[model samples]
Target: MNNLATPGMLTAVWISLIVYMGVILYFVVRGARLTTNMADYATGTFQFSPAAIGLSLAAGMTSAATFIINPGFIAYYGISAFLSMAVFLPIGAIISLIVFSKRFRKIGSAVNAKTIAQWVGIRYNSASFRLYMAFLSILHLTFIVLIAVGLTQVLSRALNVDALPALSGIVIFTFGYMMFGGANSLVYTNMIQALLKVVVAVVLLFSGYQLFTNADAGFFQQLQQIDPKLTAAFNTDSPLYRDFFEVVICQLIVGVAIVCQPHIITRSLLLKDDKGMNRFLWVAVILLILFFTVVFTGLYARVLFPDLMVAGKPLPLDAVMSAYVTTYFSPVVSLFLVVGLLASGVATLESLIQSISTTITTDIIAAFAPNVIGKQQLFVNRLVIAVMAAVTIAMSYQQLVNPDLSVGILAQNGVYASFSAAFVPLLFGMFLKNVPVQAAFSASVAAVVAHFGIYYGRLTPYMETGTRNPGIAAALAILISLLVGAVVLVLYRQTKKEVAV
Candidate 1:
């Protein structure tokens, strides 16, 4: 299909785009005026209410990755992925609230940390750690930019616009505005965008159910029409079925990456205290459950359009929802999906960009140019955002060129997200009872090495199958980090004892 949109559909898309963009812009403006100082620019002056922080965290976690790829997850894995997400996400949020925020808030406040890398620098007294952390900071910035580019593609496809100019305009306009207002704009605007995401997700949910009109037939009937294996809970004979459980289990572990996620962690720094995080933990957990559960919409797509899924074959689950959206939903609804899509992509990208800028400005830039201030600092930040935008845009183009990179591949690229390796040790050192700095350093290095080794070694089942998931590898890597951290801690303690004697 050249473009799935009709002339009538295009008009509806335009109307939704104008209204949503305007609403987003208002929040951006409001956030800018409210930002009075550098503090306000980063961490909302440590004054984010539970509501704002909760929304930012939820929105950051649930990106277009959730909207686009998650449904595909459901289409691919049936009910199992959903089950794991339900069980796993709450564990992540509780850890974030009960374990992380209080400790992080104290450290962030004491050191006046602007970014995770800056936080690491303060916590560890290591310039090398800061350098590695900055690289990871830019790493996420690259991914978010790729997300932005993907959002551009989805938006262009749905709205019936040529993608090239659309992406160029989006990159320039959004990046500049984001650099101008800094994190001040990001938090409030993200809160607003995040709120809109709720509306959009709700719309997708009901509309999806609406599209799945045959409640009487439901899973079995749909399976009968398509391959019985489409909803097959498990069958030893089928490779896909046997592998699905392992894949979802891996997803659950990668869900732990939520712990190290800097964008979400940045929200922790914004909160007033642990109370702010604990107060809204359940709400955030619910939001994620809703987000993951909504992935079932892809199942609805698979069922409702049996022809789309071939007789013997399980359709390319990744493309099924986009196809369904074009055919099944109203033009207006698809537009809202696009809006949610845009919000999700931009939200993730914006948060990453902010984190990167914060690191560069607070750690690297400030280290080199301590006297930098006002418009100049802002200019430096803008330069960082522009570079990030350009690089990610390139990554996006590469993904498009490499048609082999599916939703799962792109989403799983998150295994490489810096939080797991760079921030994890520092945060663990602060929160864990007896973690030594030396241990933190070793864990930090070991996790990175282990992640790359397990992944590239072709040792994991995911590698044997040709599909890749960094989630399980990430979990192993983190565990390795902890184990190494512990050993290093013990050794350091013993050496100190001998020195004292």
Candidate 2:
């Protein structure tokens, strides 16, 4: 029983293609006729409405990881992992909304800012700030691209096709849509994609609930039934469960790093006023509830289907999410799931491309050739965009070629890429005003070390043991980062007084 294919399912694939591609095309067309001003390219002129901004914010923050592997969290970690983000994420968004959002809007409106680099230059009066921000900009692009590639591959599987062609087509679609529409387009596209994904994921989650209640296959019972020998928590029997601290350490550390994410921060920059940021509180509540639903759906699917148990033990990253879509639902519905994946991937990549273009033109190029103008900069920017995309595509495909690679393994790289670059600087910028430019520079070095420590030190052990809670390890890393930062502040003060006298 190939089980993935049915007449109804085949119709689903085509229908979803039409619907998903149409929405994405609409997304791409939003900024097609704009002038070549850097302001126009980077921030969409801040003309997007609040609803559009909120919706896009919702969509842009999610990626293939949310759709594909988020469920893996529930399958492995139980429910509390969901609760931490449930509480933390909305609070994070609210803080952004009430505190950071207004400041960002006022600053952007006041200065006609284009990118965070431009803001840094204005705030710090330093070319070095822009240079540092630019490199950080490239780092955002890498993870964004990584997530997009994963989404496209998963979407292809939903269509019952090889992933190579899907990657090519999706990238072309992403490139064309984003290259044309720029930020303005992304605003609207994220809105559409977000709503679409939320609605679809929620519906499926509820259906999964019904499957658990009305049907006889709820997750725990199904698990008990699926394999009796599988009994026991990480400590009791499973090897991965033996080191629960590692899981807690990894996830919590990842959460702490989440504070610095540029993709998330960019949303703060797009707000119309401080009020919108406050409004973000309600938005955060809504999104987390939806996110929890999606996670549980994956967990439920794990229980419902035992055949996905790869090698009689291992489960694929898309194990529950993809299998549930293709195995149980009609093909048309599965196609919509594919569409969701594609939309998520494109929205993510579009933002990445925009960030990369801005960083290349503003940070890297203008430095060496301050006088460089117009058509040439466009050429250079496009060149950078292509080169960066090519690298991301290569990195993602290398993993895909080796299907033996688990989503969990690839996801760890995301944890490293995300936290190390974005977290420390953003935190320092907010909390530590007295730290000198050199100290800020040095903190990134410290963060890089911390990133490796968490990755090599604790996360590896947790992963090997299949431990669910990585919280303890995360707290340690953040604490270390804070202590190191304080030491930097004190040392800088001593040096400053010596120079002044």
Top candidate on TM-score is 1
Residue 327's lDDT within candidate 2 is 64
Q: Which pairs clash in model 1?
A: none
lDDT of 1 by residue, 267-298 (tens): 77776666665665655666766765566676
Alpha-carbon lDDT of model 2: 0.59
Task: Name the lDDT of candidate 1.
Answer: 0.65
Candidate 2 residue lDDT tens string, 220-253: 6666675543333332343223444433444445
Candidate 1 has its poorest 10 consecutive residues by lDDT at: 233-242
